[model samples]
Target: MNEKTNRIGILPIGKVPEIVPQSIAAHISGCLDLPAIILPSLKNIAGCYNENRFQYDVGKTLQTLESIKFKDIDKIIGVSTVDLYIPIFAYVFGEAKQGGKAAVVSLYRLEKDTHGKKQPSSIVLERAAKVMLHELGHLYNLFHCADEHCLMHFSGGLQDLDASPLYFCRYCSKYFLDARSKS
Candidate 1:
């Protein structure tokens, strides 16, 4: 948890919403007390909605990581929507391995809140916080938790995301702390 030494890199896969990724990254870095580095603007990175097919290309993502020279990074986090057609988790793993990191975190919004009405609800921000922290927890080698209210709980829908708490459960906290100890 040494804020000065721990560097978290936020990479935009393609053209994503201007707010979501930055918001998520800031929230995560604040929670973990780590230095968050947002990468420079990218060109070839395509957005999920911008592509003809909904699929994400794992190989393409790996190529992007390679192009960026992954070795200089400590950890790279990718934010994308589930609708992007590609197996985002697979791409995450591919990139993580290519970068010589233990893991990478991927995030998707559970609710459809484009206009800031209806969908996301008031707790949308909290839900986003949960997703970022949950995925970051994975980077620390933490596993899913049985506690439905814990941030580590498996979320399948907006309700699931809403049901989960923003903070880790006691057991999960121990694992998170342990991971940081090693870091």
Candidate 2:
């Protein structure tokens, strides 16, 4: 485990679109200036699926990340197509353990509009990148930002997420850069 080497892992769970894992890895590597790789998919993540709720428990899914850990992997993000929820909320685009190196983002809520219309690939990709970075930001020790459009801001729904950019705000950007430098 060489702490000096920074490598992030992007893994798809369940029935996520093929592009999401690569999209997450590309965004992290290209935007964060860190090495990123896609790990093997976790197909059985749906085993934790709630039949009545029609949503997956994200907190439990996050625990599964521990089994996929490798010495060189500094962080891991799991991408999923299923709806995700925590006990505190009805649904979440993603969830992360504060200060932990693992996170998961759900594409289920990000794929459609309020009218239940499917979003274009461009829009879907953009949303995925934003949510991925937002969840990863939490793992990086960043809080929900005050700026509404910042990637690190909390998004309770697709409209909120769509309103946000794929980039962090100035303060968050500085924090991410500073932390990367120290690491």
Candidate 3:
């Protein structure tokens, strides 16, 4: 899809800070050249909490996100403050299905460093934007990059996430462009 046809929606899930989704929307327009709008906040994350892990399941959260309908939105990125995890991974900054219409990003881990130090507001915002865009890449069918500098690189923890850039590598950039074109 061309820039005109691809409109992204940022849906704040649960109790997310207002600025968080605003930042993601700004980054989507400034970095990706796509129109992005913040949708109304949804206070739902109820059925996704896992009793065993004490963390929200990414698959279930995403399933919940996919169930929501937003008119005129081609894709959606759900932002939340809760911790999210997949069955295989201990935690994830964000999660998405390949080429799917919806994705989710969690701010629980991004607020602190690997050493558990609280980060500055700027740092937290930057990390949040990076994860948002990275998951959006997956929504467009872009995979994890071998290049560590790319935003598409899998960030297993805070340290790795800090080291990765906020933009894609050259090859991944080309792939992202192609993916957007075909979407």
Candidate 4:
């Protein structure tokens, strides 16, 4: 697939680790050979906050991503350091509208100190990129890989995420290439 024109835009929702945006973009570019960029931060997260749960509602955040004004961005990813949740699930690493333009990842659970312990920056970045790739895979209509080692594999938590590599499996890679080539 020709990747020169494929651009993935990342939106940071709130205060994030300085390394996150560029780390993810570089990882995505190198792993998928696609042009990925750090887009402007998506502040104003208050509108999406749920007072009762004290977590950001991902559904509302996706609405925000859909309404964002960008210049020919191929895919939109919203990254946040805050805890994120949907109504049904207690927590999610990220969520994407199946085959949709927008996806969101929360660095909250990706952080080792999520319950209150500090984590090394390197591990943090790795986990964040893993989750982003997983969600972005969904944006491209790539389903959860049956292969446990693939990036497209569904991750229930940090351990599950850490077990997968930062790239897609070969079978999934073919699907990714075909989908991206057609797009």
Candidate 5:
């Protein structure tokens, strides 16, 4: 594989509106300075909930992925809501085939406000961007960072998500550049 030939394909799974995927893809491409292409959504990819109704369905996710043409892509990034399950991650890895390079950025709405109110913060947009960049970093083989302010930090909740910076730390930046070199 000539490193220069790597391409990142952004697929919008399920019934998400077209604009949503395009917006997310643009942000990721801007952050990484890479070309991002949005793939058509696959039918039969309806969102589902678990037995506990926790919101997840691996089977449908895998089926959707199998329907796509992944031949030309060196990496794939899926953009969807938190309703998506961990199995979606499994599907990505399974398709990526260990070192094949693929990842998914599942967007979750922040459940709180800065003042502790139940209201969603206007910062949710920023949070979404951070999540997109963070996952893209993983696709490039970057890991969690010790810098709590960096985008690569593990954000468990709304507070942690708001606390993390939108920009990557120095080490993460270097890793991103190295990945770009391979592409």
Candidate 6:
């Protein structure tokens, strides 16, 4: 495999809106400066749902995405409409294994208000892009940054996620560039 080609695949799992993945692909190229393509839509998320929490398990989602072999693709970012949760947290906008091949971002909560009301598409798209970039940073082995302005900063809620910038900080940008070069 040619590691030099760091192409990213944006996959929609379950009933994700078409615009969501399209916007994510655009963000990948425009902000991250990497080539991104949208993959075919997947219909089932069978084992991801937790009957108790009523939320999808993020670990299981990543595992499902990793199980698929995307030829010539260096990394994949699965976008889902379902709410995602890790056992440790109430919910997570996204999840990725450090330096791993696959990551996922959920648009479920991003489009909704604190009261569960829907927000405008523009706001939702912005939130999803932020989450995708943050998760992608983890895929590159970048850790959470203390700098609030960085895209790698951990967002505890929608407000925090909203406050985060779409680009990485200087320190993280250096690390990202270093990691990309080694790829």
Error of 6 at 36 (Å): 0.3
- lDDT per residue, candidate 5, 1-183, as tens digits? 343356667777656656666766677667766766787764434444565646556445544554566767766666665455555342221112223355555544443464556654345556666766777776677777889978888776667877888789888899888876876
Mind sharing the TM-score for model 4? 0.93
**Native-vs-model 6 lDDT?**
0.90
Better of 1 and 2 by TM-score: 2
What's the TM-score of every candidate structure?
Answer: 0.69, 0.92, 0.95, 0.93, 0.72, 0.95
lDDT of 4 at 141: 94
Residues 37-136, candidate 1, lDDT per residue (tens digit)? Answer: 7776455445323254555564455445545644345666665443322353422211233213332233344445434345643354566557667767
- Model 3 C-alpha lDDT per residue in residues 113-147, reported as the tens digit of each score: 86888999999999999999999999989999999
| Off by more than 4 A, model 2 | 1-4
Please give the distance, in angstroms, between residue 113's alpha carbon in candidate 4 and its true position after superposition: 5.7
Lowest summed lDDT over 10 consecutive residues: which window, candidate 6?
Answer: 1-10
- Give the whole-model CA lDDT for all candidates, comma-separated: 0.58, 0.82, 0.90, 0.85, 0.61, 0.90
Candidate 5 error regions (>4 Å): 1-4, 44-49, 57-67, 87-100, 111-122
Q: RMSD of candidate 6 to the true fold?
A: 1.6
Clashes of 2: 0
Displacement of the residue 27 alpha carbon in candidate 2, Å: 1.0
Off by over 4 Å in 3: 1-4
Two-way lDDT contest, 1 vs 4, winner: 4
After superposing candidate 6, which stretches have Cα over 4 Å from the reference?
A: 1-4
Mind giving the per-residue lDDT tens digits that candidate 4 earns over 1-183?
A: 544446888788778766799998998888888888888786668888899999989999898898887886888888888888999999888899989989998888877754667678898898888888888888889998889889988888777887889889999999998988877
The window of 10 residues in a row where model 3 has the poorest summed lDDT is 1-10
Give lDDT: candidate 3, residue 84: 90
